[model samples]
Target chain A: MLKRVHFPASLLPYLLVAPQVFITLVFFIWPASQAVYQSLLVQDAFGLSTEFVWFENFEYLWGNQQYRDTFGRTIFFSVAVAFLSMSFALILAGFADRVIRGSTVYRTLLIWPYAVAPVLAGALWLFMFNPTLGIIPFILDAFGRDWNHYLNGGEAMFLVIIAAAWKQVAYNFLFYLAAMQSIPRSIIEAAAIDGAGPVRRFVTVIFPLISPTTFFLLVVNAVYAFFETFGIIHAVTQGGPANATTTLVYKVYNDGFIGLDLGGSAAQSVILMILVIAMTVVQFRFIEKRVQY
Target chain B: MVEKRPGFTIVAHIVLIFGVALVALPVWITFVGASHDGARMLQAPIPMWPGDQFFENLRQTFFGRGLDGSRTAPVWMMMFNSLVMAMMIAVGKIAISLLSAFAIVYFKFPFRMGFFWLIFITLMLPVEVRILPTFEVVADLGMLNSYWGLTVPLIASATATFMFRQVFLTIPDEMLESARIDGAGPMRFFWDILLPLSRTNIAALFVILFIYGWNQYLWPLLITTDPDMMTIVVSIKQMLEASEQTPQWNIIMMTALLAMVPPIFVVIAMQKLFVKGLTETDK
Candidate 1:
């Protein structure tokens, strides 16, 4: 990865790298290792004594129905968020890519939502869905359907998913638009000459060309739903309505900080670490494959 | 244009307008909520149009204590804390990443790859996963409720370093060779040549990082327990929690608007640089 003509070996390199290396060691590496170590030890009630029991926490998690339910919920949440945001962004990008006029205006309007904090996003959506005074519920009231996320588990999950997906649409839209723009215009022209309609041309020509971007956005959106949506969940649901909205990351916070189950929390952290590493590997592999193309 | 399809063109405009409306809906609601008086905001089917109370709500949210019975700082104080945290993170990350990338690319040294991998590992383990232990570490160091605890742990970024490395690699070798022939030391060469050449990338990265730092929620929520130390982003959650008692939707929405304005302004103002930074760094 280095340059061909590089400077000779010197002590200055160590001096230069010291700040980043030091921060990583202290903040990232040390804490991560501590999580691994703590996962093997369980503290008794009242913080009295600790026993080293390797893999017991993991086994306990595997056997726990609530934890298994959270695992399933997290998968469902991530997939739904990815699918919703990606498809919404794909449609918007498709339209924006079609007409060359006012695209920048549309893009500027669309991309500002990316700057919003996830917590604020939650706040905005939570306000909109406020059962008493919410506009959405007010609209639904006219249709004779009740809307209240406070007591309804499905509605709570749906609210958090919408909030999360809303924040991510800007990012996915940008990538999809870029990908579509990079496709040669000649292909679409040839398709038009073959008497294919816009829908047929898009389904055959444009969709296949941007499949890589779609795949990449899929991974990115999953990771976003996994980790970055923590603020949205915290502000909106707090894993509420009987843990219907609690994902794995939310579970880690709840168990560790609120529930005061240190060993269990550490075990959850380690599991999350493994998930993140796996996702990163997949992302890098896909990126490298795209580079070769 | 590929072909003059009038019907498709009309359909495209309609879809784009609908998309923009959906995207803008939340912000518009927030804005309308912010503009009204408190009583009006609390009413069902809250007014969709902006109210004349905009300046009054802005004054109350910015200067007055946030939410009745809440023990938080004024909105301005939290905004100040957010600014400090964001500036420190953006500048600190760029500084350290530039140095490390320079050292790795230009100088051959012991454990170079070792250090590289160590930094790369930080990317895999996000702060969310290791929240407890990381919080414990910060608590042990007595850095809680401080800006150092808020920003430093989050600044150890591998993506920025890798981006800088890519930028450096693309620079022609002759620039460094000539600098060496001029008897310039490493730091001097870095200051004179590398930094200047990568200025655009640095500015672009700064915009992205600024938004990233400003929008951080969970880390600041955990660390900054002091009222004065709370960031604007974190305070929004506290205000939302407080709303259960008093339900001051107007002031809360005003605060939300203020929280989002800075970064949104940055993105809209520097659209080109932001797009470049985002696409290049992530890919």
Candidate 2:
């Protein structure tokens, strides 16, 4: 059957892929290579001196206290955001699964945040958190606790985390909701017939069925938190008050483009690539075993 | 004799209603804040009602900025730039992904699996990892501050291609064979039969891509240095980031509202297809 298929053996893959590959190679791959190459050379005010400095840039960033601190903060930010958002998504998805009616309403509302463009999401968060005029501050003041994100690094970090989680939890919920609904109704019915209550049924049957989805979302959410949070981060804090909000990606941007330290930025980018690769590999190696087809 | 659990339903409704309110709060606040006068927006009690400043605020934002420091450019011009860039990316991604997916799924070719894995692995390398590299590339190509620079790199969407391939795989081989026997060329068969059969998936993909395309911020922000070339997201951010000056929340809110309209409509219009796309049922 396979041999009988008329395959355009010579022309097909090349024809199909030429345009995408061309664009990617020129636009994606070329630039990525240049970034790495740029990292290996030292450039001066007169222009790039182009002398290869093999591991100097990476060494400098690794040993630099500021970059190291930002790297630590970036890890903490990504992990904290992923854990908080995914946990909330899990609880909300679980709760919504039980509702026979009004579930659509819950789903739509939950999904609403996902629909808000990232730019708008940042703006909304900023408006709500603005100190003198922000709603969050007003509410906090009403409760008698003074709130400020501008001058306080911890407060700034907390607010950024909340904003990031707010934008993402809805997305995670949608995926979880779909995965939960995919569970066989008969399996749940059979479990119920065996005197399993909601919690018991969830723990034994539903959890197992949704394990794959959870694992997939874990990797997906972690990647997003690591990379995509830059928009809101850039918009809201600009890596803020005392550099508390400066993430690895933000630093890459700063060092390469803003700081004009192209070599330093490229080095940071390489490290980020390594971190993502490592995290993804770990996720697959460890979590893949827990997931069911 | 029935034991009534009326309270459970009431409690559920209450919870759902409150949850919905919380979710909608930011969107609601944005719209309301956009309409209020700028000074009024920053007052003690945040304005909860829509004001009369929408048009004035919008007009000021769009026409207020100039590119060469000589004359001001229309806000619509910036919107146009963003729209064009987004469309290029969307169209390019869809067309390429469709073709690659068809070839991968239907045709047996050497290194086919390898190509599939190569593209799919990119799904792991989140866009940020490639930024420094991508920037250097654009700069080398002299595409910095240009529209093509904004679109091309991003058009390389492995995820979309993967989705299309998966959808195409579900089509029965018998149909394709029959088409071949009837002398419908491969391209003809793909366009006429396969495409029609996959309408649901196509619609779903369009919505997904449109939302993704519209929400793109960082890549565009990095590539385009000229304000005239800026997307609404970058422009709004520039307003917020003005050093030593109080950022105008009202105008920023207004710009954000305008930016959000496209994706929101795309979602509402294709709402059914989106849900279907998310929950793919096995035939």
Best by lDDT: 1
TM-score of 2: 0.90
Off by over 4 Å in 2: A1-4, A44-48, A186-209, A279-293, B1-4, B52-73, B109-114, B243-246, B276-283
Candidate 2 local lDDT, A1-293, one digit each (tens): 13245556768667987776677667655666676777787778556476688989888877899987987898798788888888778777876877777677688767756666655677788888888888889999999988788889998898888888888877788888878876767788888878776768778888778977777777767777778888888888889988989988888887776777777777777787778778767766765374433
Clash pairs for candidate 1: none
For model 2, residues B1-283, the per-residue Cα lDDT tens digits are 0113467456656766666677678878888887887788767778887889887877776666622222223557767876787677777888888888877777788877777766766655667877767776678889888888888778877777867776776677788788888989778988998789877787776676667776788888888777678777567677676512665677677777877777777766677776665544211
Recovered fraction of real interface contacts per model:
0.89, 0.51
Q: What is residue A119's positional error in candidate 2, in angstroms?
A: 3.3
Return the top candidate by TM-score.
1
The share of true interface contacts that also appear in candidate 2 amounts to 0.51
Cα misplacement distance, residue B71 of candidate 1 (Å)? 1.6
Place model 2 in a CAPRI quality band: acceptable
Runs in model 1 deviating more than 4 A are A291-293
Task: Give a tens-digit lDDT track for model 1, residues A167-210.
Answer: 99999999998898888888889999999888888899999989
Q: Candidate 1, residues B30-89: lDDT per residue as tens digits?
A: 999999999998889899999999999999999998889777889999999999999999
